[model samples]
Target: MKSKPSGTLSARHIVFFVIAAAAPLGFAVGSIPLAIGRGGIGTAAMFLVAGGFLALFAVGYVAMTRFVPNAGALFSYISAGLGRPLGIGVAFVAALAYALVSAGAVGPFSVFAEQMTQSLFGVTVPWPVWAIGGVVVMGILGQLNVELNMRVLGFFMIAEVTVLGVLGLAVTFQGGATGLSLAALSPSTIAQGQIGVVLLFVFAAFAGFEATALFREEAKHPVRTLRRATFGSIAVIALLQSFVAWSIVQAFGATVVDVANATPTEMFAIAARNYVGDWFANLITILVVCSWFASISAFHNATTRYLHALARDRVLPAVFARRSQRTNAPWVASLTHAIFTLVLIILCIVAGLDPYLDLFVLGSVPVAVSIPAMECLTAIAIISFFLKDRRGLSAWVTYVAPAISALALAVVVYLVLANMEFYTAQTGAINWILPGINLVVLGLGVSRALWMKYRSPRLYEGIGRYGLE
Candidate 1:
């Protein structure tokens, strides 16, 4: 018999997963101050709308932990519940989503790095330098075993949250000239167009929480631990963001819209000075670098594991399935992810993309696609998985939950396509290129499935019955 894989992960490892995922939360809080000042506090409604989708998505996601625990995530679910063709389709899109994330981050990271460097050293560097450095460092860290990386991630997350908490309190105490108010909490606020925009922001905030479940096979007590982490992360981060958004509104009141509109960068700086004086604000600037780094690390780890699962399934090369003898890690897959990330970073820099907008948009597309698509597939998977038994699962989780999730994803997909122009790249290719890439990937999957259907029907059938038979 084949030797069982070694180096299982434990629940304690979740702290690192959380840390790697924490950037979504931090970026939400940090970026919201600016969006609120510009777009109006009404944008806060996006939180509720997007958060609802997340809630629906989580139900099926957590449910899957008990049945199918693997890093391939969406791909794995589809293969087990649906068939090989669908599984391959998911694998293709999932990879596209992640690759886009690394590509998209390049731009913003450059801008963030440029600004921070200017602030501290009074020297300027090319935006690409900072972006490339982040890519490199994330790759190196990803090459290491998960346990050590988790500890480092934990430290960064603590710093990120602490800074935000400090800013929230300071804004509360100083009180904007107009004072805080509950006007933003009204239903009318969500009714506004800001809800649409805010939904995008909220989606961005919760981007990496799915990464937690991606660690299933590695984790001890995979089902229980993954569920707890997934649910706990969503609840904690969502509530915390609501509080932070409220604090921001309280700090600026009506002026929150104006500030977010005119001087976006100044929002954090102003809040920092008010909360802890100039020195602390400066320190927060440094923490931004660390925050971005931690986020990159998280993505690196997640994407690598995803590749590992694909490799194991024979979707990619078998070489990708190789593990590190020293640490019992997916060494080749990690290196591949690193190299892929590096190449994308370099390409974006060479292409002269704007760091902030470019990276944000790039990251947004896959995120917009991945979670919703994964959730929808998982939902459908639930229906199919239980088609034979249908006895143990709750109705909400089995049917209503996934249906609502599918509806939400449909809406999101519609909105993304409709507003593709809003987040398009400088090359003017996003409108065509991004969606085109996903389509091509799906086509590749179909082609492969057809070839297998002709060449190795038995293996193809094996893929179809992957987990659920």
Candidate 2:
């Protein structure tokens, strides 16, 4: 007989997977501040408020780990808890969000790569070339074994934390001319307005944490280990991010003005230079390029596995279920995702977009739409898990946690919409229509699900009742 089919990932793998997903740590802390800096002291307050909201969002998210244990993440959880149509909507948004984020990174990665190449070799390459390179790397790495990706992510995670800590401490000891100020935390500053802008940044900061649910089937102990890893990932990310935000305010002074004034794309280089000196600053820039790539790689790798699972279940095309002979990786899905990334890279470049700002906003918008929906669905899942069992003690995880998370995320979504103007400078038709545009995209996904249900009821129900391929 053929060897027994392989099982999902181990518990240790689950833990390492979450930890590796931390590559966005540097980008989140460094770049987000620049987005809100135009208003001066309001920058620090924005960071604090955004960070707080994210922490709240995490509370309910972590709780869902107990009920919905699957690596397909929001797509799987919501479908299982709610119905197929809703799940399909959520899955479409999730996939769009990941792809958008990766596409947006193309600009930043190219910019950083160009910066590094120029500094080291005294040569500059076209940004598109670097973008294409990123696509290749993402595809190759995504096709590797999950365990191997986690190991690579682990090293990047440690490097990210260590660099951030060292920089934070240096800033602490130096004591800037203005020093740190609590005024940055003032309600007057945070409440001054721009709810959409603030929420958008906050949501982006917490982007990939939901990927934790995607690791459940892979976990050694799916129920316990997945729950712990999911919650633990959220907690760890919050703490580390809070620390970094505090350091930024401390280093620049609570009222440090002119942050949005950083004309260069590598704004973080300024912070690194001020906090860690020139030699280290250069190193930090290089590390940032790696960090961005790692984020893309981690997402690319995990997402393809989800496609593989969905394919195996016959929800997606059977091609996605194919495994590489050597790596046992999901071959077709990984390449498909890569090709999509490359196309996005080309389109973004052709649009003459500012690599940094354009990428950040485009990458962020889909996530702002997808994540809250996931939270709401996850809440539904939690309730289902408890109702099906009638357990007395699960009130917190199943009911309370999901409720809080869903409520907080709903509020966050509202805030993001209200403050959209603060984010993109897009004016006229683009500004008026962009939000509607995203909704249209979401609506299309819903339509696709309906079509599938009608066209192939059996497969659709299999996806609905069982899960995606």
Candidate 3:
């Protein structure tokens, strides 16, 4: 008989993996500026709010792990609570969401890498060349042992966080132009501008925390490890992002919003140059590249695992479930994801889309829509599962927490849709088109689930069940 992959991940390994997926440095440098501009000084509070909602979502999520320990995470949880058909549908959404986000990182990574190389060494490389190179490296890593990828991600994650930490400290101690204040955290400040718009970016930053549950099968102590990793990732990301946003406010003083609005893209880099030095600003640029690389690798792993779970259930081709005999890696699924990303990158090149602006914006739309929808559905699943079979679980742990999370996530979803124009900065058909595409993806998933139920009832029954062959 063939050996199955054994659990090797500890809490720390899972934590690093999810955090790397969050890509703190890249999000801060790339996305936070727009967040600050829209949310103003209160942007820090928005992160806290978003984190709180996610933490509540984790409460029931981790509780469900006791009953269902499938690597499919959201798929398994939703299926166990709702039904096999919904679970199968969720599996499709999860795979597509992660894949879209991962592919989105490619454009930014290539663009940043090209910019850094030219600025630092006077070498001008095309974005596609850099993108293809990154894909090759990520593909190689994704097809190896999970532990090996974790180790490499650990190095990049630490470096990315450390650089941000140093910059935060520098800004705090030196006290920007206003000399440090609680102004950003004030209720009035947070209510500034269109808060709904800020919520989109804040929620997007927390995209990878759900990945904790996805590693349940590989985690050493699935229950405790998943719980700790989930809560810890949310807490760390929330605190770190909040501090960094406040630091930027301090650096710019009362003019923080004006500056962010004026130079939305270069706001963070400019802050680094003003507070730290040219050398540190240059370092931030390089770390942005590393951060994107870490994010791509992290999401590639996530996408393959989701595909692996789907294949195992016969939802996808059996070939996707093939694992390496030596490393136990989901080699076929990994390769498929790599190739899928390359094809998209090639399409972007052929269409002559701007790497940072057009490709990144379009690629991010699906993930931004799908993730919150999945979270909301998962929360409902938790409530449903617990209500049907309490299994001695507390009401607060199962029902109350998830209910609150669902409500909060539903609001986030609404806000994301409401702010689609702001997100894409497009005025007409494109705005509706981006969201319309996501609805189609969701429709496809539901239709496939219904098809499976009628055509293959037995296979449908195994949708979210753990240990199914």
Highest TM-score: which candidate? 3
The reply for model 1, stretches above 4 Å from the true place, is 1-12, 22-26, 37-39, 359-366, 425-429, 464-469
Ranking by TM-score: 3, 1, 2
Per-residue lDDT of model 1, residues 356-398, tens digit only: 6665665566566555656667667766766676557887886
Q: List the residue pairs that clash in candidate 2.
A: 9-218, 10-220, 11-220, 71-214, 71-215, 196-419, 309-469, 310-468, 310-469, 311-469
Off by over 4 Å in 2: 1-22, 25-30, 35-69, 179-189, 192-195, 260-267, 349-354, 357-360, 384-392, 451-456, 464-469
lDDT tens digits, residue span 1-469, model 2: 1112235665556655665554654565455565456444444455555445444545545554444444566766667667667776666667766666666666677787888889867898877788888888778888788778888877787787788778767876787536755665577866674545555554565567667666655556555565566656666665666566556667666344445455424445677777677888877877877777777787786667667756765656789989899987788988988988787777777888666777656456556665665665666665665666634445665566566766766777676666656566655655446555556666776776788789988778677333223
Candidate with the larger lDDT of 2 and 3: 3
Per-model lDDT: 0.69, 0.64, 0.87
Instruction: Kindly give the stretch of ten consecutive residues in candidate 2 with the minimal lDDT sum.
Output: 1-10
Candidate 2 achieves a global lDDT of 0.64
Model 1: lDDT of residue 31: 69
**Backbone clash count for every predicted candidate, in the order shown:** 11, 10, 0
| Root-mean-square deviation per candidate | 3.3, 4.1, 2.5
